[model samples]
Target: MWSLPASFLLLLLLLLLGQAPPSRPQSLGTMKLRLVGPGSKPEEGRLEVLHQGQWGTVCDDDFALQEATVACRQLGFEAALTWAHSAKYGPGEGPIWLDNVRCAGTESSLDQCGSNGWGVSDCSHSEDVGVVCQPQRQRGYLSERVSNALGPQGRRLEEVRLKPILASAKRRSPVTEGAVEVKYEGHWRQVCDQGWTRNNSRVVCGMLGFPSEAPVDSHYYRKVWNSKMEDPKSRLKSLTKKNSFWIHRVNCLGTEPHMANCQVQVAPAQGKLRPACPGGMHTVVSCVAGPRFRPPKAKPGHKESRAEQEMKVRLRSGAQVGEGRVEVLMNRQWGTVCDHGWNLISASVVCRQLGFGSAREALFGAQLGQALGPIHLSEVRCRGYEQTLSECPSLEGSQNGCQHENDAAVRCNIPNMGFQNQVRLAGGRSPEEGVVEVQVEVNGVQRWGAVCSDHWGLNEAMVACRQLGLGFANHAIKDTWYWQGTPGAGEVVMSGVRCSGTEMALQQCQRHGPVHCSHGTGRFSAGVSCTDSAPDLVMNAQLVQETAYLEDRPLSQLYCAHEENCLSQSADHMNWPYGHRRLLRFSSQIHNLGRADFRPKTGRHSWIWHQCHRPRL
Candidate 1:
């Protein structure tokens, strides 16, 4: 006779009593899909589906672009950029609902796609599929609205829980190093390390909010457990003695986010002659903690510094400037913030301080990689109008239960400034001024390459500046040889870019026919300096009237000014500045109010004099 585990039977009995385990809400004809985990957007995330009132995931087997298209369309996107396999976006919880899903690219909903029977999957959440949808093409805030409208609700996720024993002051946090455990039927049970792999360790680490996993000392844990099991006088009984066995023989692909997402094989009922860990012991894992937020600790009777009191903030370890893990200088030391309630509102404050527009994403779980030292804040509550993070309210004494693994991060929105990502500036002290670098894709790999300076002009530089989120091009330089150690020291793949000065990106400009350069290295590459503001050439009207008059000056004196094209034709071989009717003479001075020096394109000698309009009474 076939028999299922007692826990499985209990789950079924609960369902029959109309007490289904907690689940996300459901709507007719629409299955909820969301992109979660680090570095994700609304259009991309680990794929989970609502089946039989429970939120579950699909197996990556036979998952393809076609399957992704259905998911994207359902979420109001036009198409998908790509699909990911093996829980790339982090593992999902609940049952591995669907397996061997085969979509024909024309299915309106994933339920209509052919698949294996529901809840009968031979796969686990470690094989969970993910999709990256194409960016929204709709105008206004429709994309944001659609994403919110389709967000998951009533979500009850399973987690890889940890219990600490003999914690050390220096390396300990609430959810850091401890015995790895999972919950079943409302009781916690430890996993045996008999066949545990590093892949299993990776999943557990991610579930705890660490970006990646590190090597764990299983031997030390084994020795500790062996000592406890051998001690008869010890009051601590083995977990097997408690009749609690949640998971056994976990097998993972190293990318799952939670332990419930891993594959498990049940063991036979325990007996006096048999033990849960007959020859092995419970699994113990020590994950590298990310950044931590610690409360401000001041010396006895000392006050906080003015800078520290005012709540200054900064970002670090981002791919580009003005984006990364958020940190605040508190108590004269930089510390990280917790992600307990991190959202776009709190992220906006950090972005504004960094001179960016707003927060693009409020990344959590040490998304940008963990930072070192104490964490200073947690449960940050902001209304999106605060000037700084310190001004936001946080839960009192919330850092007690927070862990470094749950560090918060952010990606701020740089003002688009009519620019593209393919172009970048380097060599200057700031991001606004630097040698021009273009990203070139070769053999499916992107490499930053230099643009040949030959024929490079202001028009081309304008596009580069706007693309870099800088305001305007101040100087378009042909040779940056004077500047030391150019950025992107890569190969020169393009030359002679011709821009119309209104182009949004350098790629939109016309490329020169061939490459020619006396200096070949990127150090001598073309560069540009951009500024937020530009100077205007204003006419000094007051000075103009005071300097010159119709006094019939000598042609010799006027000849120099005339030769230089600084005067009207009345001084052209005339005996003197006389009998020049309707000719108004005045000296004009131009003052530049911009950041750079101003130079007139046309000489003064080319000036044409004309009579001013006046009303005759």
Candidate 2:
């Protein structure tokens, strides 16, 4: 043990004792601030502070951007963009530590701000304050980082695929089952199967887009090749172009995101001898499609015979359309995909499969709720042209050992529909359903507020559904207090809406101009569930072509058609139905090429009647 001088120890004790009690003991020592609560983003949440050795909530009374800036900076963010009250991130428990809080926005910590002292508040849990900080500047959310090789001897694996050389293999869905071929340097080359194992096949299957790998009959392949070698016109010509084997003796652990992550060799253990494959032929692999790819009762072939492709893929736990946690169906059960090889191209495939355009963003780390059910797919590889997600390649989710935390999600490119212009839905498991919110002006301030439920019915919901392009109204709900999504959406804005059932949108219907509600203080917003198996309206072009004719009809005889705005502008300017106008006439057949029958939004009696009449004097 080392000895310290008695004079040095006395001086240190005297210096500490001479220092007066620190002005902000909590800020210098014990006080710690954090964002907590559920259904919130990482950069935004309910504010909680550590005081007296336990976590406590902050009251919203007078809490503004200045206070939020201090809280956010204390929590390691750049600063606060905005602040929320009314438990926007959800309520918090424990003591309400501070009330009537005030900050100059330059405080280094929340404890430095003025308050009614710690653990003293008149606010309830519902009044917990929250803050939204600026999002992180950069993050790799889709594909995870991977090295080209396990060691310095190799580089990152970028591309690989399957080449179907067999006559039958060429007929499948881009050949779900085929020989494994990898891209190296600049050419597509074969992988020698001399010591190829299932682990190697697993990696290959993942690269292609299948969920799992199956066994291939090597004897059958060899038997067919021996008999077909004499035919120059056979599919074997595809193989003759590539005489070189680029890879040999691959050893994969089956969990690598790409084949390049596994061990590889330029030559075999036996040495680089002629007839590279030797006793073994080129590597062959068979892929098993996930349930998501295998649409129910789908006709097998490369050509699609139906009017529309069935969708087995869906989004969940998203507040709006085109963005959500990705879920695919298998055996009538829904599951999530792991973000192993997830990227924008792969996400775009899933998006287009669901009738959207492309993926605007590929999300990772389960930004939606922690997924439920099995992880179905992983290591998905998409070429961006496939009509359905199943047409791409992927690996089984279980093979990658992924958890709910790695569940992949996507934000798709949706049609330019104006549904969100005046209305929106929130707080639902999926964007297809939620509590309805309407944009309204309150005291000259325009904001989103809840719609009153009086006279709300399917007639109104039908317009809402059509406006969203989500098909038809399955349910129109009142008293929607359970789906509490947006915090400020609880403010009741307008009431007494009555749709005529034929309106194209909810706003076109009649409603009270003044703000009114039976439950102004409650979260009783109108809600809806939309499920549209819309009847396909297809014009019979063949019929129209055969029966088409051009005629010069007298404008006076076309009064009804002209009044209905069916005539061109030339007719609108013509001498009062006295001149002749050339018109194209055709007899056409219209077909309902969909699962549901076409039904009018309103009864025939409610339809408007238009008739030709003499011009008013």
Candidate 3:
């Protein structure tokens, strides 16, 4: 054996001399990868290598199961396999640097593919990351699908018969044992018990494991049949008594053995043995007697009872003798009155209708309140007599006043007959005429003036002044006053005139005169200075147009197309003293007017129009 130092030295020399250690596999590229295709479930897909910075296809030359499994795992697939082919799954024309990739099945990604500690690839472009995944199963192992696939044909079911099973039994089983008697076809039949509970009797019978029948309540049979046997006499209570009667015969079916097929025998009323009666029947039965003689007709007077009289009294008041009565207007029909809204007028009218004295005071809103009945009168018109309140048309909103002012306080002198029952008319003062005036001015100059009777109201004065072609100088004239100066000397007469100091001139002062007599002074003293003058003609005109693209160009260019015609017309027709003319154009050109690009911007096209005006020019 060699010494440890000598052996280590020999090993070091050999490693350095020339036998190189095995190389480790390296990833062909460092880049991210993704999948793309139709049916390429997000949970599974083939892999493409992102090498050098660009995505490229991998060749399948050395594609193996381990590589495919890694790619599938990246796409959320737990178990996967790789398939490499020249078929059209992926682009087969790109660089396939990954060749013969050998990966430990445990590697997380294709980049981890390595052999002998060194990365290697034998994959061709055709192998470009193709993979198939075992997707997670959505349904449980023994789900409906499994059941459907297995089918009921292979399973056996216990059969039950419904013929003898109780209708009320639950859960029937084929393996049950017992003796069950059921009512069927009107008879009780005995049967063998299967897996039958009271609730499932029907299903068990339907399954042929047991037979079921309509269940009869034991209590019901006791009450209906057993009771009859125990108390035979009580059962005959509903039967009619007779000397003898025929009895019904019935077949003794399996369910009802008590009944039998026998003809009923009934004897004649007086010649047969009588059966004992039932418990409800006594030896002597009681019955209601038949109706007797007809009821008497209602007496004529009885038909009109005191209640009717009270009702009538309650409905009518006799204050106006008989004029007051409650009357209802309903369905456009009138009958003997029902009282409502009946007061003085109502009573007065009713009293009058009854030919009673004048209605001194018709009272309502009292203790004897409203009554109900048919309305006899719809509308009543009373001339203080011979009419019911309902007949009086003017009762509503009619005002009547008596001049008995001091009568309430009078205690002597026959009460002075204090204007009682007398109507008086309301009074007021009449409107009187005042004063009026007319003044004129021209070109801001005082021209003429006049004063007229207050009879010449403002409206009339306005018309008269306008007819006279007088521009109003002053409208200060109110009521008529006295005239005190010569004609054209600015003095006028008017009546009922009252003024403080707002007068335009003393020339409009009142003249001293007798009552109702008046005159006017001034150039217009005779009246307004009537003259015919034609209104001066004046002209002012403008032309405008609506256009598009206004924001990109000047308005001048918008109107430039017609600018020459506009200028020519302006110079020739609207120049100087004749008239004024202006042109306006709206367009998008304005948008570009101040911009460096100052070019006409293209926009929607439109047209232009002109507005011309001549004012008495």
Sorted by lDDT (best first), the order is 2, 1, 3
Model 1 regions lying over 4 Å from their true place: 1-30, 35-46, 50-54, 72-92, 106-127, 130-310, 353-355, 396-401, 421-617
Choose 1 or 2, whichever is better by TM-score: 1
Tens digits of per-residue lDDT for model 2, 297-416: 542212321212356787765534456778887877788999899887688677656544445467776755455568999999976556676777998899969997778888654433
Candidate 2: global Cα-lDDT? 0.68
Best by lDDT: 2
Tens digits of per-residue lDDT for model 1, 1-617: 99999999999999789654433223335565556654423467888777667888888998899999988876667888999998988888878877787888997677677776677568877889999987553211122211332211311123346667545622443345677776543556677777888778755664454433467677777677768877976544545675454456889765332343356755455664456666766677665542221121431111333323455676754533345778887778777898888876677667654445345457777655566556888889876456567788986324467765677887654422222668876667876787788876656787777888877888777778767767667788887866653444556867767776654467657775455666776566888998644544557666776876665544544324444554554446665545243334777766542323456567988665433322223
lDDT of model 3, residue 391: 34
lDDT of each: 0.63, 0.68, 0.32
What TM-score, computed on C-alpha atoms, does each candidate reach?
0.37, 0.31, 0.18
lDDT of 1 at 380: 92
RMSD of each: 27.3, 23.0, 49.8
**Where in model 2 is the C-alpha error above 4 Å?**
1-145, 148-152, 227-243, 267-275, 298-617
Candidate 3 residue 408 Cα shift, in angstroms, is 99
- CA shift of 202, model 2, Å: 2.1
